[model samples]
Target: MKGDPSPKTETHKITGLILAGGQSRRMGQDKAGLIYRSRSLLDRATDLLRHLPVGDIVVLGREDTKYGVRDTEPHLGPARAIRNWLRRQDKPMNLLVIPVDMPELGREQLYELLAHEKGAYFHDLYLPFYVRAAKASAVHASTERMRDLISAFDLTELPVPVHWRTALMNINTPDDLRALEERQLG
Candidate 1:
């Protein structure tokens, strides 16, 4: 039996999670609704997920029942929003989490994360995480900070290539958005 062929591994269902439930205090508005490249950030995020092989896509923050699910408790943070969403899932699945503010993130970066069998994220970046739904309780038990939640799980820290550094930039303020726009134009 040493050379026996092994059974095929079952692929876990993947759910694309867009974390849009931020108060946007720094930008003084809802970051999800901000217009970038003539489309709302939320729309861009959804489109990115749609291009992937995910089974379902969920938006956490807005109240549009069609594709959005409001966080169990609003304005808490990304960690709490993710925890709430994971707890409500009917079954365990793989979650590809992204933030609405990361406009520069492309399919290539996401695909890179998907390449890892165990969950993986950029070395220093906390968002754009690929995690398992079965770890919901672990997330819930962690502190509200995203870094704390990341430490609760065994996730690989992928090295970011030089070309992908811009993709990790998060637009947290009007200045950041303006700088991104300038870079795009120039």
Candidate 2:
């Protein structure tokens, strides 16, 4: 979807959502804390999004701001984290959400993805191909005091460039880290 263009505007419209609250299991550590280059993966991901021309940048994490994270409350899965982050916003806006582990993502790739998104209705805007957000307060309303209903949206994948495929890689294992390091060195 990154290659698709919209007729409404040439610049594209969207917000940046950084998913950062995962309890890392496979990596034997918090995936966002993994160091890449000179900064932690969390710092790198947030910085990359900050450089984008999006409306707002929200960090969904579990109280870790030393890396410059704003920290969203009501930590849940990526789905819930995203919704809670969205609810806190002063205004409604489209989002470009991705996990913290995707450290190699480039600004031009993100902009290209935003250019192709379209909304189903006026208030219901479509996000990038990687993920989409919808107003689902009621869907998550039935689970105790928790907003568990606010989960992942219906995803529509976009085909990115072959070299950029690593940009979506979520480092989950030692091998994964090794592979990334090798790629960096090579």
Candidate 3:
């Protein structure tokens, strides 16, 4: 169920929510603030989301962006972040959720996911998902595993483009980032 893509529409009021609230245990610092190719991951993620057709965009950490929502409940992870935002919404919200550390996720890559009305998943990499507001309550009720949330909805796994495969990985450590750099260089 985690890697599955369910049926649903992709139109209207889609909020591009950059999930930048993680504790960055692997990176030894705030990965969101880390610079990748001269731009901070936070800036990079927000810029990528801006190119999408989403109605609004918000960063879950760091106020450097135009619209930033400080994590009111830190250390709790993505579910807490979603729950916190859900309480502030007037109705069910459609979210194109991305992580700050994913430097390889570009506009084109996101469009692939958006192409599916039911939403998309990365198979093994369950993040950068299309989260429907209707399933938020169910996710909260279920396991905290981010995978479980996608499982509740029918999500289709977009075939990873050969060129974008390595880059799509969530850069969790400096080594991971360096490996990406090496791949690019070599």
Best by TM-score: 1
Model 3 has an lDDT value of 0.74
lDDT of 1: 0.80
Off by over 4 Å in 3: 1-12, 63-65, 132-135
**Model 3, range 1-186, lDDT digits (tens) per residue?**
232223353334688889888889988999988888889888898888777777788888656567888877777788667666666666777778888889978776676676666678676777787755544455455445666667766677776768878667889899999998787789
Model 1 CA deviation exceeding 4 Å by range: 1-12, 140-142
Predicted candidate 1 versus true structure: per-residue lDDT over 99-123, tens digit per residue: 9999989888887777766677898
Local distance difference test, each candidate: 0.80, 0.57, 0.74
Model 3's C-alpha root-mean-square deviation from the true structure amounts to: 4.4
Ranking by TM-score: 1, 3, 2
Tell me the RMSD of model 1 versus the true structure.
5.1
Shift in Å, residue 78, candidate 3: 1.9
lDDT of 3 at 133: 55
RMSD of each: 5.1, 6.0, 4.4
Q: Where's the lowest-lDDT run of ten residues in candidate 1?
A: 1-10
Backbone clashes counted, model 1: 0
- Preferred candidate (TM-score higher): 1 or 3: 1
| Model 2 stretches with alpha carbons more than 4 Å out | 1-13, 66-76, 87-91, 119-156
Tens-digit lDDT string for candidate 2 (1-186)? 453435543223455667677777778898877898879887887788667655556566745464334445444455555555555656545566667776776666666655644422111112223333444342343332212322233333455556766765667787888999899899
